[model samples]
Target: MTQEPAEVFAAFRHAESLVARRRPLDALVALAPVLAAEPDAPSVHLLAGRAYLNSAQLLRAEDAFRRVLELDPSDHYARFALGKTLQRQSRLTEAQTQLRMAVAMNPLPEYQEALGEVSARIAVEGGR
Candidate 1:
């Protein structure tokens, strides 16, 4: 099933809206065709990664974020997202690494907060 570019674009937008609305399952459904149609689109993967992360599909979110990184290593948001996903999965060290990189790439408050969180967690766990 080949989707026209316009259809793919519309679907991608719709999926993005769904993700924003906190409807990750619905967003993933809407994104399926777009993902198939635009496998190389880093934005699409980033959106899907966000949807997956919101839905608590940590491993899938990790994979999606990794894909975005592979496509666009300079995407600081993707690194932040991947860090969050790893943090959720209890991979604190890996999460800290990603969040540190994200903060280095772009020092957004949210990224800094995330990095601080993972650092605190690692520190706490290490103290145990």
Candidate 2:
């Protein structure tokens, strides 16, 4: 039987609640089935990426964020998350590029802050 979109979204919501409770493992487990069934669900991918990131699973987080980007190329949040994952992995140049793209796509204060932080780090590293 096919699940309704609303049902899928409800499962995503539950996964989000688990993340909010600091149960990222549980969130990931809960999201797994939904992700397999709806691979292109941007929001689910975004949240799964976030949960993985929170759990320090950098590669998995990157994959999830990349999937989100594939599904919604214009999603600034996914771009920002990808940038953050790159930064965490010490891929400074790539992080900077992604962060800049995110900032350009949407000049939100958070994106600007992340860009500024990445810029400062790059400058500091370059001076060393």
Candidate 3:
């Protein structure tokens, strides 16, 4: 039998609650099934990416963020998360590109801040 969308959404929310409670492992475990069933859900991918990031699983975080972008190219949150993940991995140039795209998409102050920070890091790295 097919599960209801509401059930999937509830599970996603519970995963988010786990992340909020700083139980990233639990969050990941809770989210895995939902993600497998709803791979195209951008919000689910975004939350999973965040949980992975918080757990320092950079590659998994990157994969989750990439899935979000693939499902919805215009998702600023996904772009931002991807950028942050890249930046943490020291892929400054790639991170900057993603950050720029995110800023162009939304122009939110937070995006601007992240873009500026990444740009500065790139510039500083280039100088070294």
Clashes of each: 0, 0, 0
After superposition, the stretches of candidate 1 with alpha carbons farther than 4 Å from their true spots are none
lDDT of 2 by residue, 35-63 (tens): 87798789888999999999999999999
lDDT of the candidates, in the order given? 0.93, 0.90, 0.90
lDDT of 1 at 84: 92
lDDT of 3 at 63: 96
Name the top TM-score candidate: 1
In model 1, what is the error at residue 128, expressed in angstroms? 11
lDDT of 1 by residue, 28-103 (tens): 9999999998999999999999998998989999999999999999999999999999888889999999999999
What order do you get sorting by TM-score, best first? 1, 3, 2
| Predicted structure 2: lDDT | 0.90
Candidate 2: residue 78 Cα off by (Å): 0.3
TM-score of each: 0.96, 0.90, 0.91
Model 2 is weakest, by summed lDDT over 10 consecutive residues, at: 119-128
- The candidate maximizing lDDT is 1
Model 1 weakest 10-residue run by lDDT: 119-128
